[model samples]
Target: MTFSLATWNINSVRLREALVLKLLDQECPDVLCLQECKSPVDKMPLEAFAAAGYNHVVARGQKGYNGVAILSKIPMQEAGSHDFASLGHARHIAGKLENGATIHNFYVPAGGDVADRKVNEKFGQKLDYLTEMRDWFRDNRPEKSILVGDLNIAPREDDVWDHKKLLKVVSHTPIEVAHFAETQAAGGWVDVTRQDIPDGRLYSWWSYRAKDWDGADKGRRLDHIWASSDISQSAHSSRVLRSVRGWEKPSDHAPVFASFDL
Candidate 1:
């Protein structure tokens, strides 16, 4: 079976329901995983997504904060969810497709502006969350799984527009990058996006503060798509829909995509 999947951080699903529908209508990916939905599951406007032919959904949400949802054209059953670091946030959800491939959608905490955990509680929470993820994956050892979402960290130098300048920044900090690398290693997850586009300054998110985001081209590869080593070889054709960030009232994030022939 061949299928395509996309991951996006919609920021607020309720406010951008139209944009979500537009993506479904246009791109029509087999599976679409969203983070930062910022709405309760009951209020997610799932009916609209259903009408768009994505009748299957697995989600965990909160009132106006972190949330995740997977809308799939193919049938899938809810696998589970986790509250990493006991932060009490709706940040992770998983679903199992009929083809036996499990999909995990996550919205990792974006460590606050300050990178120091000693002074910044949010930064501490982010690191703790990543640590817990590493431990969980180490114990669970997932296989035939695809994990995707707004991980909120740019692990590589090329992932950020100015890596040297952002080294002290929250997302590109050494400590956070170490935690991210440990988690990837623990899970044995293959970065399907990087594997396809091996060389380039790829980015999935741009700061809203940028007056001319496109012209300035200051962005970060905050979102990611990863597959288990067992199925990584089947993943290909990865790309980021950069133009979506320019859509009317769009999210700061653009959708990242990968196709799989399983």
Candidate 2:
């Protein structure tokens, strides 16, 4: 079977339900994983999404805060989820498709403006979260799985608009990148997006603070799609919908896409 999937940090799925619907209408990927849903599962617009032809969903959410979800046109079952750092935040969700492939959707903490954990509790929490994630993958190696989310870190130098300038920034710091690498190694995950587009200034997020976001073109590849080596070669057609950032009242992030021929 061949299916397409997309990952997006909708920021607040409730607030951007229309945008989600718009995306479903424009480029109907077979599965779409969303992060930062910012609403309780009961409050999510599942009815609306179902009406858009995505009938299956697995999600974990909270009121006005962190959340993650996976909506699919194909049959799926809720696999499970983890609290990672035990932060009790709704940051992860998983689903198993009929093809026996699992999908993990996550919304890792942004780590805050300060990279130092000394005075930054959120930064410390972010680090702890990743450490737990690495351990989980190390203990239970994944196969025939695809993981997608707003991981909130840019691991590659080309992932940022200006890597040197952003080295000290929260998302591109050396410590965070190292944690990211270790986690990737633990899972034996192949970056689907990077595998397709090996080089260039590829990015999926731009700050809302930019006065002329497109013109300035300052952005980061904070969102990702990763597949375990067993199914990595089945993945292709990866791309980021950069134009979505220009949508009316859009999220700072753009949707990233990939197709699997498993």
Candidate 3:
């Protein structure tokens, strides 16, 4: 079966609940993976989603902090969850389908302001998180898998609007890029978005601090969908819903989507 899967960092699930419904009504992705939900499992407004025909749900959540969830129209089984860097953050969750394809939804920490880990604990933790992820994947390689989330680091120069201008920026710093690349390599994953839209300044996130976000358009492609090499060849119709970024009370990050036939 062919189905569309999408990932978005909704910022605060509670705040964007309405917008989420709107997107579901419009896009109708079979599976929607969400990051930065910022609500506990019980606190998540799942009833509305169920009403919208998205009954299958699984998530790892913490109150007022990082969270991730997968809402699907098709039934799913809980695959697993992980604590990257042992940070005790609700950042990773997985789901498995009847077809045996596993989906890992992640919310990698957004390392603090400074790039130097010595001066920034969050930055250090972020690097450690990536390291652990690489080691984990290297040891227990995944197959027929689709990974999606606000990975928080824009690894490619073309991923940012102005790479030179954002060289020292938190998300685009060399260290973050290198670490993310290493993890991807170890995981044997292919960047589905870039695989389809190979040569362009593609972005999924724009800072809310920008007075005129569209006018500035200084955005980064921090959100992504990666597939294991085995299933990467099956990925088709990849896209980023940039229009959702302009929606009413929208999340800073837009939804990244891809359709697959396995």
Candidate 4:
């Protein structure tokens, strides 16, 4: 079976329901994973998504905060969810497709502006969350799985527009990147996006503060798609829909995509 998947941080699903529908209508990915939905599951506009031909969904959500959801045209069953670090946030959810490939969607905490955990509680939470993810993956050792989400940290130097300048910044900090690396190692995950486009500065998110976002081109690769070693070889044609960032009242993030021939 061949299928395509896309991961996006919709920011607020309710507010951007139209944009989501637009994506479904245009791109028509076989599956679409969304993060930061910021609405209760019952409140999510699932009917609209259903009408768009996404009949299967698995999600965990909270009011006005972190949330994750997977909408798929193909059939899928809810696998599970986790509250890493006991942060009490709706940040993770999983689903198993008929083809036996499991999909994990996550929205990792974006460490606060300050990178120091000693003085920043949010930063500490972010690190703790990543640590827990690493430990969990080490114990479980996932296979035939694909993980996608807004992981928040940019592990590679080329992932950020100005790596040297952002070294001390929260997302590109050494500590955070180390933690992210450990998690990937634990799961034996291959970065599908990087594997396809191996060389260059690639970004999935741009700051809203930029006056001329496209012209300045200051961005970060905060979102990711990872597959286990067992199925990584089947994943290809990875790309980021950068033009989506220019959509009307769009989320700061652009969708990351990949196809799998399993």
Candidate 5:
């Protein structure tokens, strides 16, 4: 079967429920993974998603903070959650689909403005998180898996509009980039989006700071869709829905999507 999967950092699922529903209608992805949902599992508006034909959901959430979720039209098994940095953030969730493929949804810490641990605790946590993630993948050695979410690091120079200018930026700093690369290599995960549109400027997020965000287009590829090497050949037709970022009251992130023949 050929099915589509999408990952979006909705910021807050409750606040963006309407937009989520609209995306369901528009994108028609078979499975949708969300990050930064910012609401407890009990508070999630399940009916809205169910009405949109997504009957299965597994999520990790907390009040006004980090969260991740997977919604599927097909039945799913609650695979698990993870605590990477021991920071107690609700940032990871996983599910196994009826098709026998596993999906991991994550929201990596943004690592604040300063890239130094002495002055920035969040930055330190981010590095620790990446280290733990790398070790976990090394141990588990997942196959037929799709790893996705707002990884919060732009690992490639082409991923950021102004890589040199953003060298001091939290997401594009050399340390974070190295750590992120290590995590990716540890899992042997093929960055699905990059595989489809390699060697070019690509972005899934744009800061709201710009007056004409679309015009200025100083964006970063913080969000990602990576798949295990075993299933990499089945992955295809990936794209970032930049139009969603233009929607009224939209989240800073746009959805990244891919199709796979399983």
Candidate 6:
């Protein structure tokens, strides 16, 4: 079966519920993985989602904080949920599709303003989170899996608007990128997005602080979709829905999409 999938950091699922519905109506991906939902599962508008054809869901949620959920039109069951770094945040959840492919949706912490862990606890948590991710993948050795989310790190040089200027910035910092690469290497995951669109300044997140976000284009490719090497080749049609970022009361993030044949 071939199905299209999208990963988006909805910011606050309850706050942007309408936007989510709009996306479902417009894009209609078979599977949608959401991060930073910031709404407890019970409080989320699941009834509305089911009304739109995404009747299956696997999720881990917390009230007004980090949360992740996977909504699918296709049949799927809860695979597992992990608390990397023992942060106890609703940051990681997994679902197994009927085709036996596992899908992981993650929301890695965005290290705070200062990159130095010595000065920032959030930065330390970010590093520790990545470390745990690496260890988990190393042990699990995932196959026939696809991982996607707002990973919160831009590993490639072209992933940010100004590579050199953003080198000291949290998301593009060298240490963060190194940790991100280690985590990706651990799973032997293929970056489906980069594989399909190998060049150009690609970005799925733009700062709300930007007065002219589109014109300035000071964005970062913090969101990603990855497939395990075993099934990576079957992934295609990867793209970032940039226009969605301009939607009214939109989240800072735009959805990143890819289709897979399994």
Best by lDDT: 4
Name the better of 1 and 3 by TM-score. 1
* Worst 10-residue lDDT window, candidate 2: 199-208
Q: Tell me how far the alpha carbon of residue 235 in candidate 5 is from the true structure, in angstroms, after superposition.
A: 0.4
What TM-score does structure 4 among the candidates reach? 0.99
Candidate 2, lDDT over the whole model: 0.97
Write one digit per residue (lDDT tens) for candidate 5, span 84-191.
989999999999998899999999999999989999999999999999999999999989999999999999999999988999999999999999999999999999
Write down the lDDT that model 3 would get: 0.94
lDDT values for all models: 0.97, 0.97, 0.94, 0.98, 0.95, 0.96
Q: Could you give candidate 3's per-residue lDDT for residues 170-207 as a string of tens digits?
A: 99998888989989999899999989999989999999
Where does the lowest 10-residue lDDT sum fall in candidate 4?
207-216
lDDT (Cα, tens digit) per residue for candidate 2, span 1-262: 9999999999999999999999999999999999999999999999999999999999999999999999999999999999999899999999999999999999999999999999999999999999999999999999999999999999999999999999999999999999999999999999999999999989999999998999999999999999999999999999999999999999999999999998
Residue pairs with colliding backbones in model 3 are: none
Question: Per-residue lDDT of 1-262 in model 1, one digit per residue for the tens?
Answer: 9999999999999999999999999999999999999999999999999999999999999999999999999999999999999989999999999999999999999989999999999999999999999999999999999999999999999999999999999999999999999999999999999999998899999999999999999999999999999999999999999999999999999999999998
Q: What TM-score would each prediction reach against the true structure? A: 0.99, 0.99, 0.99, 0.99, 0.99, 0.99
What TM-score does candidate 5 reach? 0.99
Name the lDDT of candidate 6.
0.96
Record all residue pairs in model 4 with backbone atoms less than 3 Å apart, i.e. clashing: none
The per-residue C-alpha lDDT of model 2 at residue 159 equals: 96
* Candidate 2 clash pair list: none
Give candidates' CA RMSD values in order: 0.5, 0.5, 0.7, 0.4, 0.7, 0.5
